[model samples]
Target: MRVFLGITGASGAPYAARLLAALVDAGCEVGVSASAAGYEVLATELYGDASLPHDEVRDRLVGGLDGVTVYAGNDYSAPYASGSAKVDGYVVCPCSMATLGTLASGAMDNLVHRAASVALKEGRKLVLMPRETPLSAIHLEGMLRLRQAGAVILFLAPGFYHEPKTIDDLVDFVVARALDQLGLDQTLVRRWGQ
Candidate 1:
């Protein structure tokens, strides 16, 4: 699978990081782009240093990972920006409500939004994993609009029915579903009714 993973400004940096690793482990060709705030989130949540340089953060996030390419937030010329590119799927992990509104309103300000727009227009799989609480009416409506547009709004909430005992387990629960949505096999979590 060829996948585009967009990291946005949200609270679930762990989810985004783990999902990126899982994508590469699944043998998918991955393209990554992080918004300015996304980089901060990664640095703060994952590294405990919000002031870490972008290059260092990038190195930490995708260092030594093969089959992955990192693009700038403003890199509109990326292959994922166009539907003509053979992208199998697109994911906006830790998708901020701002990004949700932009995508729902058919607005594209960066490569992330453009890639998602192309996914929607081309009828390809697009998964948006947002992490937020107490959503207002605007957020709900935007999510509804995107759902109706055929995008999967997979929240970063994990179920405990599988008896999760650690934070990584909880994170894997969500990432496992995301991998499934992208039509990739994942053994991170045991399947229900197994």
Candidate 2:
């Protein structure tokens, strides 16, 4: 699969990292783009240093990961930014409410939003894994709008039904669901009946 993975400014960096790794492991060619604040969260959550520079943070994030390409936020010429690029799917892991609203409003500020817009306009698979809590009416409305537009609003809410033994387990549950939305097979978490 050829997929675009957008890391937005949200609180679930672990989920984003895990999902990126899982996508590569699934033999998918992944294109990644991180907003400024997305770099901050990844540095703080994964590297324990919020002061890390963008290059360092990105290096550490994709150091050993294969089949991945990183794109700049303003790189509109990238393939993922266009509907004619033949992208298999697009996912915004740890999607922020701000991004949700932008997408819902049919506005594009960066590659992430543009990729998502391409997916929606082209009728391709688009999974938005928002990791928010205490959502306001605006957030709910934005999500509903996206769902109505044929995008899957996969909230980053991990289920405890599997009796998670660690934080990784919790993250995997949500990642598994997101992968499922993109039509990628994952064994990160057990199914409800299995």
Candidate 3:
């Protein structure tokens, strides 16, 4: 399956990174985009360098993962911009509120929003993993609107039923749930019965 993974400025950079790695390991064709703030957050949270070069930044963020294509946020001509591109699904692993609002309002100011809009218009699976806390009414409304528009709003609320013991486990829980939404089987998290 083809997947579009969008990373935003949210604090959960590890989730996006893990999700991309999992998708690649699962043998899916993945297209990735990191928002401007996403780069800053990633630099601060993942990499120690706060002023890394763009290519070096991407390399550090992606860590030599295969089967994934990275796109610029401003590049509207990317394959994901066209409905005929035939992407099976799209996931904003750490979707920011700004991006969510843009998607809800039908604003294609960037490639991330545009790809999501394309997914919605084409009736493809568009999963949003919003990583906000103490959500305001506006955020809830934006999520509601996206849901009504047929986009799956997957909040970054990881379940503790599996008793996660580490940060990686927590990240896996959410990524596993995302993979489930995409209809791909995974054991990233322990199931209730298992």
Candidate 4:
């Protein structure tokens, strides 16, 4: 599978990082992009350093991954920016309201928004993992619009029925669910009936 992963300026950096690794582990061709704030969050959450350079933060996030391509947020010429690029799915992990609103408005301000727009227009799978709490009406409405447009609004809330024993387990639960939505089989978390 060819998937585009966008990390936005949200709180769930762990989820985004885990999802990227899982996607590569599943043998999928992954394309990743992170916004400025997304890089900062990754640096702080994953490396315990918010002062790291943006390139260094991105390098840490994608350094040892194979079959993964990293794109700049403003790279509109990326293959994922076009429906003809044969992208099977697009996911915005830790999707922020700012990014969501841009997508909802049908504006292609960056590669993330452009890729998502292409996914939606092409009838491909587009999953958004938003991590906000206490969503305002505007946020809900944007999500509703995206849902109505055939995008999957998978919030970053993980189910605890699996008796998660660690923070990584909790993150895996959500990543597993996102992979499921992409029609990718993964054993990151135990199945409900298994």
Whole-model Cα lDDT per candidate?
0.95, 0.93, 0.88, 0.91
Give the C-alpha lDDT of model 4: 0.91
> Per-residue lDDT for 100-141 in model 2, tens only?
999999998999999999999999999998978899999999
Ten residues in sequence with the least summed lDDT for candidate 2: 181-190
How well does candidate 1 score on lDDT at residue 156? 91
Residue 147 in model 2: shift from native, Å? 0.6
Summarize candidate 1's per-residue lDDT along 103-166 as a digit string, tens digits: 9999999889999999999999999998789999999999999999999999999999989999
Looking at candidate 4, the ten consecutive residues that score lowest on lDDT are 54-63
**For candidate 3, which ten residues in a row score worst on lDDT?**
48-57
Question: How do the residues 53-113 of candidate 4 rate in per-residue lDDT, one tens digit apiece?
Answer: 9888878888899999899988888898888788889999989999999999999777888
Q: What is the TM-score of each predicted model, taking all chains together? A: 0.99, 0.98, 0.96, 0.97
Choose the strongest candidate by lDDT.
1
TM-score of 4: 0.97
Candidate 1 off by > 4 Å: none
lDDT of 2: 0.93
Q: What is the lDDT of residue 73 in candidate 3?
A: 91
Which residue pairs show collisions in model 4?
none
Worst 10 residues of 1 by lDDT: 76-85
In angstroms, how far off is 22's CA in candidate 3? 0.2
Native-to-model Cα distance after best TM-score fit, residue 125 in candidate 4, in Å: 0.3
